[model samples]
Target: MSAPTHTTTSEPFDFARAASLLTDAAARAGAAIMAHYTGGTEIEIKADSSPITNADRDSQAIILEALKVLAPEIPVVSEELASDLTASLGPRFFLIDPLDGTKEFIKKRTDFTINIALVEHGRPCFGLVYAPARSLLALTVADGEAVEATLPPDEAGADLSKLAQTRLRARVADPDGLTAVVSLSHFDPETEAFLSKLNIAERSSAGSAVKFLELARGRADVYPRFGPTMEWDTAAGHAVLEAAGGFAVAADGTKLRYGKTEAGLRNPGFVAWGRKAGASHH
Candidate 1:
């Protein structure tokens, strides 16, 4: 039997419904991840020297299965399955990072997360980031409606509405000083230089999408990354941050866009801000 598909229609896509589906998928993936987290899994190195584990594959499989039933027509560009990054990607697609912080996960850190997002015309319209080990779920339920909830990874496909949620909003930067969230595993000299240019009063290091969560939750004012990253690594978090009244941009101050097929889906250095500060800061 053929897999089910969501029929294409002229009617607008229901983001709230889609968010529900994604939340369930993410929760399922989280459960799968925690299984490996507790049982322990072996790691292998990819051609790029990045690490991969069975947990990543298991999570990817669960999410891909859910997405297939959700909207099969929309091609999925996932980190684990993307062998050809230079290939053309149309205006809309689903992006997935089954595991965003492989290094941290291998190190037994709780900062890793599962990321899923819908990119339309190079902008992420919906996104979900779930840190299973942390029991933290952050996502955009609808346009301009972002929230976080406490959800244990063992709960398979739990209904999001039943969980108590905290609305997310990025805090404005303090004129005198800013709190910067930097990469814990991928910190680079350029990121240090970028922070130096700002009147930063505090700094914290975190792994994976957790950095984005900090800004979304008003715990940090900015996140700067000069290291290389793939689209899947940041799209979902970017969507969440944008929904929470924040924005991300390249070093040149232009908006960060997805579907960079020519660039091999690789991202340039970018900065995420709680609020768009003056150009002087960038």
Candidate 2:
């Protein structure tokens, strides 16, 4: 069967509804993570050497169920389920990371996140990143459209109704200075050499998909990854960054696309930078 179609009608973007659902989902996932965080759960390695826990599976199930209820028609491609559905997706779908930063979570750090992105025609049209422990939610819809909200205590469990909205924008300090964001966990020697060549002034280290959020909020300038990442790892972040006048592209300058192959979902090394960087670098 074909995947369900996403709504294109102009029926007002439901920021409130989206926030509530995402916050609740994040909180639910967070609780699961906390349970494992106390340190009794076993950890197993995926073929890629990534760690997986009961928290990841439980959280993914929670997010998947919540998303289905919130937007039943939208198809979902969550990291936990990608292997099963990767070959069957349609033009538009939701890319989700239920427990992004499982490594961090296992380490008892608060760097994990719940990521959701709306991908249409191989590009993200909307994106949301929820960090449950921090009670933070970052959202971007289109160009000049973005909001950062905090989840309320009362509705912390998938409540789609109590998110307090706040505005967010990219921070451009020098406009000419090269600021780069590199991975805190996946940094490599080659990526370091690349940044050195650019003469970057400010460097930021963030875990999970929050690197994309940093770029979206203008907190950092550029992100260059020479290693590997799956489509789900960067799709949502790419959407938010693109909406904020930034983009994540292959090192060769092609826009990142998803649903390519199953043998390897690892993405090519890419550079993410703002509109100004495009003029100077690309």
Candidate 3:
């Protein structure tokens, strides 16, 4: 496949501008989520059996509006609005999981996140993952450079005033004693078998895209997923992982690509790692 084309105008993408937009969108989404959260709204099950709440709708609306103003020409495929235009998407688009870990959100676990990615030619070129409850935001571009910011502790939501930024890079561990990050919500037999095949030294469980953020921050070495996921579920996290000197690939030894088919946007099993040998082992 050809490399994905970025959405650039006469000038190159302004990273600062993009980050600013993302931060603002995240803050607005966070506020919307908090309102629903405090109201104790009842949750409904979607057609796929996934839980949805007012938080999901309000957050998605905020994000969609912000992105339209920031990059109006770019098309977006958000989880909340995917069904409306799944069949009409072109080659390049934005894949968004406006509120990931809805289950966690409904349970008030504070592990949910707002995810967005700029996908071109079926690959993510820029990504943003924000955990508003924790005031953590991760952003990355295509060239393996990522940064994280922690917002200040404020009752208001995603306080921009408390932006403490830091560059992120993966830690190189001993190839023999690698660690793996697994999701606390979805663990299947296939993932267990895959883990048994490796000489894993430790295992950690996290919620939503935070697992990927752990790997990107060098706190974890590998993350393997054998169960079903959607393109929006992993696109932003995948871009952040790739930009932090890591890659998420199919268990069959291929780079994980997006925009599979009209039947659905489900993603196959994949592994994410910081080292090439990790991919080989999987």
Candidate 4:
């Protein structure tokens, strides 16, 4: 089914309820990931030689099943299941990256995560990223409310009310004193050249969508990703940052758009930054 392209402020889309359901869904996926994390799952080679495991497959299965029940009308585009699925997608769709950091997950690092996003008219309308190994969960519906909470031991039965919620806010970047975040797995010279243009105070590298988390939480000021990326890789993070009053813009200073049919689902260079970054840093 086609998704709604726009909603008025009074629209009946309940973000809290969506966040609740996504929390449970992500927690389930995370559980599936952790099960194989310590249990030693076999890895297979994808066409690109990237690592794939039962954890990735099983986690996507759980998330796709959950999303089907949550929003039956919306289509789903998942990384692991893409091979068997068709390429055509609706204006609105659910995107999933059951295991975002395969290398990190394989090495038992805590940088891995599970990502889910709802795209409407080429923009992220809802997003959730759960770092199961790190016990951190982020949720946003692009309704001007974004939050990050700790996943309780019983994530499946987490008390949505009792969860300590921190409303995400993007802090202003002192351009000359900014803490820049970069990719840990795929650092390239292009990114360095981009950073040199900025007056940065420190540089940090991380894996998966955690870079978005840093910006949303007001811990970091900017994340300039110049290397290759897919639509799924940035959609969830983009939604979360937007909800937190931040932005993900292209090289030409335009907001990032999704659902690229011509580019084969790949993304161009984009900079993820806080709300005050553009006004103050530029």
Per-model C-alpha RMSD? 3.8, 3.2, 3.2, 2.0
The C-alpha local distance difference test score for the whole of candidate 1 amounts to 0.88
- TM-scores, in order shown? 0.94, 0.85, 0.89, 0.93
lDDT (Cα atoms) of all candidates against the true structure: 0.88, 0.72, 0.79, 0.82
Looking at model 2, the pairs that clash are 20-160, 21-160, 24-158, 170-217, 170-218, 171-218
- Candidate 2 lDDT over 181-262, as tens digits, reads 8888999998888887775778988788888878777788888988878878888777767767777778888877776655
For candidate 4, the TM-score is 0.93
Q: After superposition, how far is residue 67 of candidate 2 from its true place, in Å?
A: 1.9
Candidate 4: stretches off by over 4 Å: 10-13, 84-86, 153-157, 277-282
lDDT of each residue in 1-282, candidate 3, tens digit only: 233355454324455566677777787787778777767877899997998988898888888887888778777888888665447567667888988999888888877888998777777768899887887889873346788997522334453335777877877656688788998899889889988887889998878998889888888888999888889999999888888878888889788988876637778889988645444544
Residues 1-282 of candidate 4 have per-residue lDDT tens digits of 554546777644556677777787777778878888879999999996788999999888778877877877778888876663436687888888888989989888888888899888888878888889998988884486789999942436365567788899988887568899999999999889988888889989989998999999998989988888888888888889888988888866877898886777788998999876337333
lDDT-based ranking: 1, 4, 3, 2
Best by lDDT: 1
* Model 3 poorest ten-residue lDDT run: 152-161
Global Cα lDDT for candidate 4: 0.82
> What is candidate 2's TM-score against the reference?
0.85
